[model samples]
Target: MLGPVAAWDPDGTPLPLGAPRHREVLGRLLIARNRVVPVGRLVADLWGDEPPAGAVGAVRTFVSALRRALEPGRPPRQPSRLLVTDGPGYVLRAGREAVDAWRFEDIAARAAGASPHAAVALWDEALARWRGPVLADFPTAAWAGAEQARLEALRLDAVERRADSLLATGASRDAVADLRAHVSAHPGREDGWVLLATALDRSGRRGEALESLRRARAALAEGPGGHGPGPALARVEARILSGTGGSAAEPGGMAGGVWDRAAAAWERSVPARSRARLHATAGLLRDLAVTGAEGLGEAREHRRDLVAAAEATGDTELAARIIGSYDVPAVWTRADDPAGAGELSRAAARAAARLGPGGPPALRARLLSVVAVESRGDAAADAPLPRAADSPAAEPWRLRAERAADEAVRLARRLADPALLAFALNGAFMQSFATCGSAARREVLGAELTRLAVGHQLPGHEVLGRLIRLQACAGLGDLAAADAEAEEVDRLATRDERPLAGVFTSWYRALRTCETDGWAAARPRYDALLATAAGSGMPGLSRGAAALVALVPVMRGDGLPGPGLARLDAGPYRPWLDPLLLAASGDAEGARQALAAAPRPPHDLLQEALWCVLARAAAAVGHEPVLRRARDELAAAVGESAGAGGGLVSFGPVARHVRAAGRALGGP
Candidate 1:
């Protein structure tokens, strides 16, 4: 049950299960963990949306085979005690110790209340039960998805808990290797990053700790939800930068001493029912704090429980905070979950109302900052721009976000708290992105952040500041500064074991070569960058690089292969690249249609390069209207190189594209 579905005899010999279908029956029963699974549910799960005429009969046959294998020695007349008939279905009747997965869960549950040393041993014993992925042999079965995800999450939690125990026992160095592996495999897990950084910092590897935080920020930003470093990472980073060792007292600051002390006091003073509710809320918050994108569904469940528990405690501030703290490090701001963001916004507003004018300024500032951040919902800095008519609807939120950010920064600065100021400044930066022409503003914000971060010795914030500055430099077409910043980023990334750190620098350099030399000369560089992006878990970068690699043949007039064209169709740059590919393939009308339908990418580091590509495509297809549009857009950065702005792929100078579009439109 922990790995591939199978059974073993009393002496550890493997017992042969009949067929795949028979094994699936056992697997389903085992997943129920000794509970009854109805025959109808089993049939529905096995067939999915369409069941055969005799699916119930097939299910019974499989169950019969499973029963035979489980009780080979049972007398013919005696009723089987193991696989007994229950209401509506069959029950496996396996005890906790009979199955590895159930035993593992039991051990984990016990470990929650154990001391550090005992917890370490228990976690080790539980983790040792896993041999591979859950239902390893049924990779594509629809029935396996939920159980696999649940068990895998449990396994991950076990590993993290073990690391926490190691940290608690002052074995920080011992925890680093496993934590590094955990973060590498599960880069999106903010808790993994937090624990890894804490372990590295406690081990006196301060540089690596900062690097881990930086990588965490980048990895989270690249996800579908496009979130920044959430509160958990931010708090851990602040603790590390303040030179607070990851003592057993803090252990990554996951649930700090303050919470523990307060909870203990409440237990002594409050009613038992209230104390129970408090304890439950605390447990839910801990779970929420550690969960990332993969566990968002679970996080939502915890959020609901915490909200209910918070209300039950009748503490207004606690309830507000609990409701506001649904800050899983994913999909918080993305358009896909508007209801979630709206809930958070309402929570923050409620918190603000409760705090009143006399509440702690820091708390108020933090709340304001959260509001500012949330106001940018669906307007992610790198997201594609909406149509012209939709722009007006977005302006009010942007202005409100700006106001909130300004006030938050003012309050933070008035307090002169570095951590609070960093938080405020981050919100300000996130809201700085407009529909277009935001590079200059980001450049200023980035500089201020870098200065503040450097002065306070906040290495994680410093890295983020530098990254923003690097993107701004590229957008502003300052190649020399961009190159220098890229070098620094590469150095920090290499020192800290962040494989994805050097991607930007590598892309920038390759694009430079592609612009100066030719496609043939830069082909190998693009190829290598593509491989690096894929291996570093950067699917976006990989797709961008793949598009560029595929274009090399097209640029040489050799035409793209079918697979290459198919790959091009799926990338973000498909709108621009489609026209170029179609024009090169002798389909002028198709190229024109693609150009007409293409929406402009959001104004960011990559906007100029994409526009330049569109400009070339327009010129190749002799589409004068698109040519004029491209020419006007490129004219803004005529002296700058287009591809250098985006490190992923380059298409030469902005001036060249502008001039080509001008000629196509019968201008200069």
Candidate 2:
């Protein structure tokens, strides 16, 4: 039997035995309806600290009386006819008309539809019958306290709504006053301050508005995410400090309902007529957009659909919450037009403004940042932007890497659909580590990574599984495993460019000069990678590799390697190609001094430092500072556009001069 719903039919005549104790227990049971109300909890709520002799008997007696009254015509032997037995207690299955509690909820839902005046009037009328603290007319027990809290929460809701209507209708001052009281009545809530601030700001009292936000922040910092503030309040506060919104949250990359396959999810999950899949789907979408769901797009979408569908199935309260996105940092990892990037950033911000409370905060923040960064014209991202899309000077091996890294970030926050959000994040992070080469990031991405591996994403979780092991192995200094992961990455490589794994392979090969011989030697696989990377434009690390490899082949000779040096200077790729050119000329003294002018890290790993050592030995070039900068880039390689983990590393050898002067540039 289903549990009791809120009672309706306010005019129905009251019936039966007048046992106060039984009425108290029945009210408690009705409130908790479907769930088990433990014996200890019931007793705690029933007797407080003072249970009389045989208090247990008293409870049984009350149960017996209530059953007899509710089911007078039923068999005397079946007490469960009125209250079904459950774990340690009983479940009351009365109709809504027989239970006032459920009826209260119905009234709340109806309030959303009513006119301001009608809504307030209707709820006030309904609330008038809450009648001395629900089940409160009985003993002061723990269960009674819990029941009171629940009903009080509803009462608070009424007040909040009243305030909402008032604010919308231009009674901002009144709304603030009412909300202040409402917040007090429901202390330590994040939404309260946001609401309070909104009302105050609307009323033209800006300082107090900010204060409200501050209070909320402080309170929420303590935990439970209780102090959930709304975006409107933050906007209001922003206006107070500046003409425009202050510190406005940056946008994300994924646009609005564009990705929302809500309709599709609904058709698939819901039943014939009474189907409720939309509710579940919407909720899941909201959560995926807001919290850390996964690294796959489809998984996130499915979860969102499930949430929406569930909400459609009579979970109005849940449905009401299913809205908007999170501020995951807007960036346009997609190497498209700058104008497009700007629009994407703004859209991301708007989407985040709509997000309520969600779990994927890290992912959300990252998404917004991706958009914002892109809009800023991430010249710092892949660098050499001018040559990226169409420069004969581009490197082939890095095309996929640049695209993959940028795409991964875009995809990460780039979703309104839960599954897309997850897959993208997974791809973004894995690709980020692989191309950028950051071990620290690799360390912290586990838990969220695991979710991507689970039901949150793909059927096999195979890609993510491999990616994680790859990250772990890299972090632990397991070179063998790292190389093993590289093998897998190679197996999966395709023609369009696999930025994630492909970049990992290419960069690793270039970093330590590992593939410098192959690229510099017979075939020019590395050189081919550079020449063909035109479609998506070269990524930063790829450009770095081009310059680095150009210096490789020139080092194949003896003494000063002068003849090898001539190969590089002859190419039209001169001004922009100076770094590699200077190093390979064996004017070791001249090159080191040239680099000393700008001590930024060149692309190669320790090879830069190795070049400095070699330059010092050659003794022709003089300045040590340039060598120092080159060495710095080589050794400490921080934040450079190099791979971090997920199977990307700098494993190439001493091609610092060899590959540059010969293959990539011209000769050999």
TM-score of each: 0.47, 0.33
Worst 10 residues of 2 by lDDT: 248-257
Give the candidate number with the greatest TM-score: 1
lDDT, each prediction = 0.68, 0.45
Give candidate 2 regions above 4 Å deviation: 1-451, 458-479, 487-524, 527-531, 535-547, 553-580, 583-593, 602-620, 629-668
User: Model 2: per-residue lDDT, tens digit, 136-184?
Assistant: 5554555556666767777766666656555555666776776787666
Q: Per-residue CA lDDT of candidate 1, range 85-159, in tens?
A: 888998898866889888888788767656788999999999999888888878888877898899899899889
How far does residue 19 in candidate 2 sit from its true spot (Å)? 27
TM-score between candidate 2 and the true structure: 0.33
RMSD of each: 27.6, 22.0
Clashing pairs in 1: none
